[model samples]
Target chain A: MLPDPQAGGQTGSLEHIALLRPLSAEQRAAVARQCRWRRFASDEQIIDHWADTQDVAFIVEGRVRVLSHSAGGREISFTDIDAGELVGEMSALDGRPRSASVVALGEGALLAFLPARPFRDLVSGHPELGLAVMLRLCDKLRGATDRIMDLSTLGANNRVHAELLRLARRGRRQGAAAIIAPIPVHSDIAARVSTTRETVARVMSDLTRDGLLQRRADALVVCDLQELERLVAEVRGAP
Target chain B: MLPDPQAGGQTGSLEHIALLRPLSAEQRAAVARQCRWRRFASDEQIIDHWADTQDVAFIVEGRVRVLSHSAGGREISFTDIDAGELVGEMSALDGRPRSASVVALGEGALLAFLPARPFRDLVSGHPELGLAVMLRLCDKLRGATDRIMDLSTLGANNRVHAELLRLARRGRRQGAAAIIAPIPVHSDIAARVSTTRETVARVMSDLTRDGLLQRRADALVVCDLQELERLVAEVRGAP
Candidate 1:
């Protein structure tokens, strides 16, 4: 049997990422040759926040988690990065220290890296790429702002509810229910919303009893996304 | 007094903002003709989130706040934008609806607008300008991430302490204290930290009794920035 074409076999070609669309075929080919690509196994550390990275990387295949550790030994995962998206560009672009470490979420995940100098030239030589990068960064900034809004505005249970709604979109549908495959453990939700695992469990328990939330084998099923959002908003003022 | 060169007077020339350094004099003059500038009074609404702005704006003088209203009518002020910075670019760059409204906090706030088409040309014409914009966006992204970390990792009082440390640097310093002139009101601090006014007031009272924070004639004085940092770190379980 032929091996799956992309099963972590190579770095994702530049053409696969929309951000590099402005580059001519020759430019993309040249960039491909200059870049370094590697496959990572599940749970492998990708980059350390303490040390600076000289090259920027893109996720070519599979998912990885961005996270940090607090002085108290508490770990918080920021967000999951998917294929076709750029990673580790923040430090190289702004000359700031890396803010988080990354680890692969699955085996056969691919990553591609380009040295800083060449990457700069690529953007400068192709101004379209610059606009693309700015658009991408703006989206990240907006997403971060939304999370901050949630953290500052929502209470513990409402935050859990909000997170569940976000997760629901990733799952399969079953008769009006959205099943988030491979359910996130309570601790994961707690870290995302800055609350306690026990509090999350309690909220989930109550929601389950009320039939607003459900659990399937290895997945969480959100039955009513709209209702959940309404409930969250109502909680913001219910006092 | 020479018409107060910047205050409610003239739109700033492009040369004054650091980001435009890459533009040639001719280019700056041409771009200047394509853009618009005006001043706003205190508490004046500048843009609506419901609409998309075709032109991006720059703050030439005074301060403004970026904020949004929750469905329940609770207003969350994301951050204050100071003079000599860009605003409303995110929506124009990404073609997304404006995410928040901006309002001037003081009279004589000068704002400049450059149409989308010329703005695009300006960046694409000069890749260095693209690099500059990316650097600026990267800085904003980092600041947002820091706020997210603080929200997710710190409790109410520790968040308060962290914020004070941030504001203290803006004021005059005595032996070991930095006096933040025109102290941010309790509600403002609450809005920034995602807590409530009562919570901030209670925390301030505790800190005052402990002699770690003080109020001096419409100003908030932070005593010992190092101690403030230490306290915040200790809350994270540092010895």
Candidate 2:
């Protein structure tokens, strides 16, 4: 499901957007006037895979997950975008069908949409924005590469460990460990690493049994971050 | 093994490069004068995973395979870049280590190299080049997304079939059959699909037995493209 192109919110300023930050206030205001804005509630669909519309959207508030469904109704999550980030540029730049669907996470999201032509013009007109776009794409490409390596070379258990390691790295660091507050949902992890929820549960239990993980109310603490890294490194091998 | 950045090739022009194609002749000449050129023999390494250099290289002739090795020395092929494509931009644009190793394929390769600064300047100064780079990255991202879906959902046999279908689509069509000249190397396909060579061999044999594929002295002919597509679609579910 996708929100209607013209139905949701009104246009907003581009002042807070990371990609447009390098532009001057006057420039930002000029660009913002040409865009439309919308608000979506939690679990709302923002864009559908293969949908024909090709407007680029900036996530001005809230987080969104990018994903697609296989013919079997299995969902494969790609990557999530936070506020100040953007999506739909793939279709905007290449004039191809949407690569994946996008859905709002947590609270509802506020997004500013720029039609493909204007989006292209803005990027081309601003070198800073152009470089920013390239850098963002590079970051995504690298993340995708690592995921490919994991899927191609690692097993389900190892993938779950790797995903946990990734989550831990992004979590808040404690004295000698990392605390992932509000532990991630098992099914979500399963979707990300392409495994079953049961497998994720099994791996979590194993890690707990080995004293590498500790589960507490509202948080999953890595009791020994180094040990967890070592486990992942052993499977990934030398790189 | 990675080639020394300063050890290979001399400087060359930006003329005939796809990313630079939109530039005028003068612009191409001006940009070309700032680049270095080199020739890599078959099987020669162009760049290594985690390499430190950040110069962007353009393939002027021949093809190269992008891949990485696991700790156990297993090779995972990412994608192949034919003439007119570029590589090393991940590092060049992001100022990070190379994400994967690249090696020349077939007879050899002729490439033009542009130092990171000039490459960035050329792209940022020219909107067309910037858009071209974006489009190229979009293509890579889309391809990687497809591979991710395949790796996450498809089994080895189906992955092999999907890989074949991909190759067949790129191959010569002969009425009802698609002929892939010189046939692909099973091991290479195995590397691409994250499966064992033995498994690829077994799948190929099964496909031949089922009369879906025909092996010849110089090519592998897919008997029915639609049937192969149907087989892949059946496993991928309804997308």
Candidate 3:
């Protein structure tokens, strides 16, 4: 069962997000009037696979992760969302049952929930609004395509290294090293790289022993990004 | 290397394709003026991954299959599209290079190509055109999500059954059996199900021996879809 969204505290406004920032004040106000602001605690589902109804959720604060769970309670994650990103629009656009569940990732998250009908009215009438959604969808499609390619073609070790390199690009950089905060658990890494937890543990241990990776209390640090990149590219015939 | 698009015949007119059907005759004329008609032979790539530029392609006739290839000659197919579908819009939407290559599936295919700028101009300015594209994009997103789920969660046997059920939905139906024409090769099945050619051949032989499937000269027939569905569902924890 999913936890209920707990609402409180300051949140990012519609005027500030990347997609909505392009809208004029008047347009922003119009959208704001129709949207319902809600907050959810970490690990709480914003959308569930079994749910028939869905709203377009725009992330206002914190992060959200999209994933699907197996019957055994194991999950496979697809993507993560930060503030200024949107969630649940795939179901809103296609009118299908939510194919996956989205959960609040850290601490808690704030979202502006726009019901489908009004959301469609706004997007169809405003070219910028529609383009904003399309642009984001395109990004998701490209990411999905890359994931499919990597999962199908690469060996498990290469996949893990490749995924780490990808996460490093999005993570915080300190000097020459990249840090992924709250170092993902074995299962999370397993899910992302499409390997088992044992395999991930083995690969991670090897990397740590080789000094290519270092796990601090709360983060996984890549000591040398170049070496990590080289590891990921080796199987693809890269020199 | 990719084969060139072959040109000839009376293709589906721009006005007849689903996306352009709602355009006014004048609007259609404007679009038609900017559109180019082309056809591609079987296995010919409509859009190559190496290309830097892209145009929105509307399928007027025949089918196109989308897939990504690794440097070592392995590939993973994502989806197949038929007439009334559009392709290459992802690159147009995000201004990225084509991430996947699309190839004509059957004998040949006809398409109406609209260069990126003009296509965007029409879609952004016109709600119907924009919505049409959005709907298609949404469909692709959902399909991608499903593929991700199946690839990540299901075992090889379950994945094979799941893929067959999916193909059966799109293939021709006769009595109790679902027929997939031009019966996909073992390698193709392996690619789709994320297994090896030997594994797919082994699974096929088993299914045929069990009387749940039959092999025709140019098609694979599922003789017992219920049993196949049962097989797929049991692993998925379906009731």
For TM-score, the strongest prediction is: 2
User: Could you estimate the TM-score for every candidate?
Assistant: 0.88, 0.94, 0.89
The digit string of per-residue lDDT tens for model 3 on B1-239 reads 11223323322356666877778887776776677778778899888877787788888778998887676877777777888778888887778889788899877787778898988888898887788788888787777777777776777777877878877777888887889887877877777766778878887888899998899888989997777877887777633
TM match of model 3 to true structure: 0.89
Model 2 reproduces a share of the real contacts of 0.84
True contacts kept of each: 0.74, 0.84, 0.62
Better of 1 and 3 by TM-score: 3
Mind giving the per-residue lDDT tens digits that candidate 2 earns over B1-239?
Answer: 22323475345555557887888988777766676777899999999776689999888788999999877788999999988788988788889988899999998887777889988988899888898888888889888898999999889999999999999999999998999987899999999998889999999999999999999999999999999999998997745
Which ranges in model 1 have alpha carbons more than 4 Å from their true place? A1-15, A172-175, A232-239, B1-12, B236-239
Give each prediction's root-mean-square deviation over alpha carbons: 4.0, 3.5, 4.1
| Candidate 1 lDDT by residue in tens digits, A1-239 | 22233564543466666667777878787887687777778988887877768677777778888887666667777888887777888776766788788888866467778877887787778887888888888888888887877777777778888888888867777777788888889988887777788998999999999999888788788898778767766755422
What TM-score does chain B get in every candidate?
0.88, 0.93, 0.86
Q: What is the DockQ of each candidate?
A: 0.55, 0.76, 0.57
Name the lDDT of candidate 2: 0.87
Candidate 2, residues A131-227, lDDT tens digits: the string is 9999988989999999999998899999999999999999999977999978999989999998888999999999899888999999999987888
Winner of 2 and 3 under lDDT: 2
Query: Which pairs in model 2 have colliding backbones?
Result: A71-B237, A71-B238, A72-B237, B10-B37, B11-B36, B13-B32, B14-B32, B182-B218
